[model samples]
Target: MTTRVIAVGGADAAAARLAACLGGTVCPLAQRRFPDGEHYLRVLGAVEGADVVLVAHLHPVDPLLVDIVFLADALRELGARQVGLVVPYLAYMRQDRRFQPGEAVTSVSFARLLSRSVDWLATVDPHLHRHAALSAIYSVPALAVPSAPAIARWIRAEVPDAVVVGPDEESGQWVDEVARLAGCPGITGRKLRHGDRSVEITWPALQPWRGRPAVLVDDIVSSGQTLVTALQGLGAQGLQAAACVVVHGLFEQDAAQRLQAAGASRLVVCNTLPQPGLPLIDVLGDLAEAAARLIAPRQG
Candidate 1:
């Protein structure tokens, strides 16, 4: 069977890389918004009877979700045999449950929406809080690709005498894993978020590694407050801010500036989103591998 990779808008580079890895053709998607605020999308190539891999990063989830559904339905309508999704940064995953009464479980709801659109799904380092895995929420075959190995490799190669630090207790596991792979010491701090832009961070005892370069690792850096707070705390403890590593760098508003102001020496992120300026650690290989497994013929 012929496998074709489709790069949705904003995911062209990632899709191209995946296509090269799979040795498949790249299908382009033409998208635009109507004057009335409606979206219009069209697959620019033939997909009849072909296995389609839709490469997208559902970051600003709203319009992208619409685009995804439209694309998937169009492919199925055009007689595509299978549809698989490779979402590098799956959004709306942070809201796993309802904190307030009458609040919606958006994680499950979003999972259901995507599951209905494609046969299988793959994502990189989704913000999996409260849920153990993506499969716990998604009804379809869902795979969460870890960025720790790649991040660790980058850290090992770039940062000397690196001491991995997790911004909060929630990131302890990921921080420990990266440290283990990089063969460095790891510690996690405490974080208290009062609002979107307001946060407080308390670092653990860093007296042992005071002069060592500290790399703060987190799954996502949305508002960048946590990272800013951590960077400030690290500076106060006499540790040099080597770098801030994140899987999904949703560096909103003044995030980049504030990080630098707080004494972050460098900022690195996985290529989950289209970040132009910062260094992007490639995760396309990992995404393609996972997608290949899903689209491969089932063993007897």
Candidate 2:
């Protein structure tokens, strides 16, 4: 089926790339804020009887979530048969479980809200810390596409003397996979989380991979505390100023400046999130592949 791809907010560029991949038409959308700061959205192209894919970069999430639901509903009201979402960097997965009393589990809630709003969903390597997969929280046909292969390829082509270093134990397996694919050795560090911005990392002995250039790898780089600490730890071991590779680059506030000051030689991230002046590793192929698979012809 020929699908119609519509992007909300700052996802027009990504939507264009995915549309090219899916062999879909890029549907025009008009969105703006009112005097009182309320969102307004309208689908300019016809979507009747067509499969519509909503492309969204859900960082700075709350407002986009609101806009997307409205836009999805608009598509349905305009006679669209199905609505799917392609959120490159999905948000709210961090709060999968409630550690404190009376805290809201936004992961499940966000999934519920999104599942009801769209028919199917696809995202690039969502943070699945507690739940095993997207099926655990989302009721719709949703999937997380892996970016390891793409990352590995980038590392092989770019960083010749790369030694993959995972900042924390949570990323041990992930780091190993990337390193194996990149044909480089990998090591993981232990982390004791004091808070969101505060973390204590225990670096493993650096004797084995001492002279090689380090590349700190992780799925997400929000606030960049973990990365900052990792750079310092690696530098202390005489491993030279290391580079950073991340899937989602949510460098909030002064995080980017901080990472630079912390001695990160290079900061590379996937095109999952739109940011200015940052080198992007293309993951649209993976996203398009997964999204196309999910929306493929379903036989009765």
Candidate 3:
């Protein structure tokens, strides 16, 4: 069975490229928003016995979810052999557990909803806190691919004289991995997060690496407070403005602008979600390999 790659929302180009990489065909998805903010979707083409991979980035979570859920069901009804999902940046992963009384563990709940829909799922650098892996919550075969290699390659090629810096101790392992892969020294700081917007971070021993520029690495940036805090600290020490590299650039509202104002010389994110005008580090190779692995069983 040939694999058919289809995109939801604005991922059409990425889907076509992925289809080309897999030596498959591109199946377009028809989507429209009704006056009342409801979703109207149609999966175009004839896939009587073809395997389909639906590519979607769950950034604007709610509405896109409606499209994904409906399209997945339609694929099954239309006689597709199997349906696979590639969610570049998954939403609702921040609250994996309940901290206080009567709170929803959205991460697990979202996982349940998706597990029932798609045959297999994959994402790039999911903010996996508490849960060991995606398989812990998802009933289907779920893969969480790493974007460290891509980030490292970018640093090596673009910023040759750089020392990787993680904003907090929680990110120590991740920072070290990227640093090791980039062939540079890495250091992680300690962070005391008061709330989502308010945070306090202790500087790592950045003085030793003062000669080289700093590259701030983060998995996902929403409010940009942590990175701003890190930047402020770096500025106080008279260090060069850091180059910010993130796996997922979930900069809400004017967060991206705010980050640039906060002394970020360059801001770059993985091609997980499209950020117009900003430079994107490609993770298409990683995504294609992970997606191919998911649909391999059906072809076999």
Question: Tens digits of per-residue lDDT for model 2 on 163-257?
Answer: 99899988886799999999998999999999999998998789877778998889888899999998898888878656798889998899988
Candidate 1 per-residue lDDT, tens place, 1-300, comes to 777898776888888899988878998778999999899998888999898999887767798899889989999999899999998999998788889999999999999999999999999988888998988988989888999999999999999589999989989989999999999999999988899888888876789998999998999887888988888888899889899998898888888888888888888989999898999898889888998888886311
Cα lDDT tens digits for candidate 3, 134-234: 98899999888898898899999988788888888767767998999999888888899999899998885667776568899999899999999998988
- What is the clash count for each candidate, in the order shown? 0, 0, 0
Q: Model 1 residue 277 lDDT?
A: 91
Worst 10-residue lDDT window for candidate 2 reads 291-300
Off by over 4 Å in 3: none
Model 2: residues with Cα > 4 Å off, grouped in runs? 298-300
Model 3 misses residue 218 by how many Å?
Answer: 0.3
Q: Which ten residues in a row have the lowest lDDT in candidate 1?
A: 291-300
- What lDDT does candidate 1 reach at residue 293? 88
What lDDT score belongs to each candidate, Candidate 1 first? 0.88, 0.89, 0.87
Inter-residue clash pairs, candidate 3: none
